[model samples]
Target chain A: MAGVDMDMQILIVDDYKTMLRIIRNLLKQLGFNNVDEATDGAQALQKLRDKPYQLVISDWNMEPMSGLQLLKEVRTDTKLKDLPFVMITAESKSENVVAAKQAGVTNYIVKPFNAATLKNKLQAVLGAF
Target chain B: MTDQAETNGHEQRLEALVSRYKDIDPDDLVNIVEGIINTAQGDLSSVNLKVYGEIEALSRYIHSARQEIASLRPDEITDEHIPAAGEELEAIVGATEQATNSIMESVEAIEKEAETLPPEVAQRLTDSVTQVYEACGFQDITGQRITKVIHCLTHIEEKVNALLETFGEPGERSARERKANETSGAADAELMNGPQSSEDAISQDDIDALLASFD
Candidate 1:
């Protein structure tokens, strides 16, 4: 596979600070250094509007707003509609996957994923990493 | 001679009267009455004793149950203890995040410094750094599980508070307390399920299969 751009600005969103850090570290291992963090989808949306992020990796469950809700908002917005969105969730229920698919998520990754799984999902979404 | 004969006849009638009355013994009649009275008194006393014992046992049981309920006050379970535990968990998560960030930063620095080293040695160093990064991933899953635990504790606290309100005191119930009581039964089933086990949760492959069906 060809090399992935290490400078692609990515946003990692989760309610847990530890989750955000772990994702940030994982992205760093995959050679993506320009990563921003958000505690939830609401904050992630704010950051998304304020800055240009090539990719969004977000947890599914959160207070006030969820990753799926954020995805819907992104899909509805004319400017950010085509942005790549990857959902990170602990649930792999069929209904949840279908909902995410209908919401136009680029890809889905389950929790407790290793660097290899992350790489594969990134490759699938962003192409040849 | 005629007077003597009449006296003898009267005497014979008197003897007959005496013989008929001989079958009725006053001593025996008195003994039978006394025995019946004694048996009735014994039975009555035994019944009364048993009833008193049962009443005493029931009273003791009720007293014990009341004490148990009193011990289950909101202060014991719902007070600062649960919230404090949640705060402690939050602090641990925060510390873990900080430590993980430090490790990542150090790894990055090491990776940068490994540029001038032998190719194999640099690759090994990079691999080791990657291992550290992967190890830090535990914090995320652990944090997620702990969040669930905190949520459970919060639910328990709500229930304890509601119990205290309903059974605690008269006229001390607030609107919030009433609302808590009303909504206590309405907890989300998903949230209440806590952390799912491997058997309970579907795998990524299952998700992929479902997504594939969408196509």
Candidate 2:
């Protein structure tokens, strides 16, 4: 896999603590050691602004600011606009995909994905991994 | 003899009139009877009209209350949300099971290979594998929590449906209709399907095709 360096900084955002833990474990399995977490989109956006991350994986449903809203914010910000963003949601609707695409998401993954799916999605966004 | 008989008859007639005069005050009795009848008629009509009006108002209030309760079908909390959450939980369980199995298989494979390795290295690998096994126990706890959540949601749905049946308006949407009308949001009407059944949701291939079309 030639996609992302294992040492690259990654930000994962989800409202559910279990989900966060699950994703963190999956990333660990994938050998991605440098990872941070935010409980909601607002906190995620704050983290994005404060730090430099190679990737952002966010859940769609969250309080205060949803993943879509956060995507829009990331796309609009001058410094963060180029950051590769992936939306991880249980929502499988075509409209959601289109909206995320329109908002400039790097990729999309439905929830309950395994290490392989995450790896493939990361590869698609970053390079051949 | 004829004069005595005439006197006896007149005296009997006078006695009969005087007997009728017992329980005196005929004028007052006439007034009492008239008053009772008049009051009964007047009061009954007035009271009956007032009661009828009150009943009409109560009916209207009930109708309004029913309409309000029917409208309380929340936008956020849908019957779909519960099932979607369940599906997610199921997926998690399946994934965890698969991972656990894979880890066990790997450990067994490693055990066969470990015979060539030194004692300390073999022990370390075994301990690491054991930790992986321990971590997989999270699935059991998560599954229990998800089951509890599903039960609570099911209970809520039953109560809501019952309330709707008892108080909802006739033309209000059925569960089917409400589901059909459910939109994800204005921004992503097409993409708002949370979790779909096998039939309704498109596959990853379909998503790829859709994305390809946009290009």
Stretches of model 1 off by over 4 angstroms after superposition: A1-7, B1-67, B170-195
Which candidate number maximizes lDDT? 1
Instruction: Candidate 1: give the clashing pairs.
Output: none
CA lDDT, candidate 2, residue A57: 95
lDDT of 2 by residue, B77-104 (tens): 4456655765777787677656665665
Local error of candidate 2 at residue B201 (angstroms): 2.3
Residue B140, candidate 1: alpha-carbon lDDT? 69
CAPRI-style grade of the A/B interface in model 2: incorrect
Each model's backbone clash number = 0, 4
Fraction of true contacts retained by every candidate, in order, equals: 0.42, 0.21
lDDT of candidate 1 at residue B65, scale 0 to 100: 64
The TM-score of the first chain in every model comes to: 0.95, 0.95
